[model samples]
Target: MDFSIILMIIGIVCVVVSFFLKDSSKKIEKDLEELSISIYQETNSLKRRLKVVEEELLLEPNFQVKSPLPNKTKSSINQSFQLKQTEAAPAKNVKPINEILVRQVIELKKQGYTLQEMIKMSPLSEEQIRYILTNNGGIQ
Candidate 1:
């Protein structure tokens, strides 16, 4: 009789412990469900905020609108810069440096010197010597 009574007490203790374990499992599941619902709500709020940002970006105004002005076109700007570079090149009556060289070659050639000979004796360019020979006393 004593052994049987001890067995019954042990069985009752096991049953009580099992009941408490089942209730704790239910609480854990309920907590997990609440966390899932809160996370879903936050994700939906973020999606709504993203849509509002997209709408704002689409409807916003641009700052660099075009305006009419005489100097705004490319041709007018280029013309202004070109006008600055051109300061009316000097008057044309004076003999250029090449003409002066040709005059020297002619004087030397008239003193009985061939072109090959003038080539060695004078510092005038070959084109100047040729111009002097070919022009026949005309001051080109």
Candidate 2:
């Protein structure tokens, strides 16, 4: 009779422990879901803030975002920064070489120029001319 009582007690303890564990597991899952949602929202907020800062940077004319080393002299920094500014300025005015070359290649292709002739007249390589012709729905 004492043995039977001990078995019943063990069974009751197991059932109570299982219910407690199940409830705690559900609470843990709810907390994790809340944390995941919070992180996703924060990430999107950071992305929006970054886009605003980038737009502001682009709008400012004299704001040079320099990446000079901490130990660099001011004169050296000025020289390097000026060089970058000058190089970046001209890029806005000139058309890309590829766009110009593609137009020239299209004209040459229309004129029945051979591949070798097109390659000789333009700075583009033979492969580049062929690629442009093939991809632009021009002659083979």
The segments of candidate 2 whose C-alpha lies over 4 angstroms from its true place after superposition are 16-22, 60-140
Candidate 2: minimum summed lDDT over ten consecutive residues — where?
65-74
Candidate 1, overall lDDT?
A: 0.57
Candidate 2 residue lDDT tens string, 1-140: 99999999999999988876757777999999999999999999999999999887555433433423232332343344445445767454322223435566878889989899998999865655665676553422
TM-score of each: 0.37, 0.36
> What's the lDDT for all of these models?
0.57, 0.64
Per-residue accuracy of model 1 over 1-140 as CA lDDT, tens digit each:
99999999999999988877757777999999999999999999999999997676444422122323232332333343334334333342222223334445767767788888888876655644564566435432
lDDT of 2 at 125: 56
RMSD of each: 28.1, 14.9
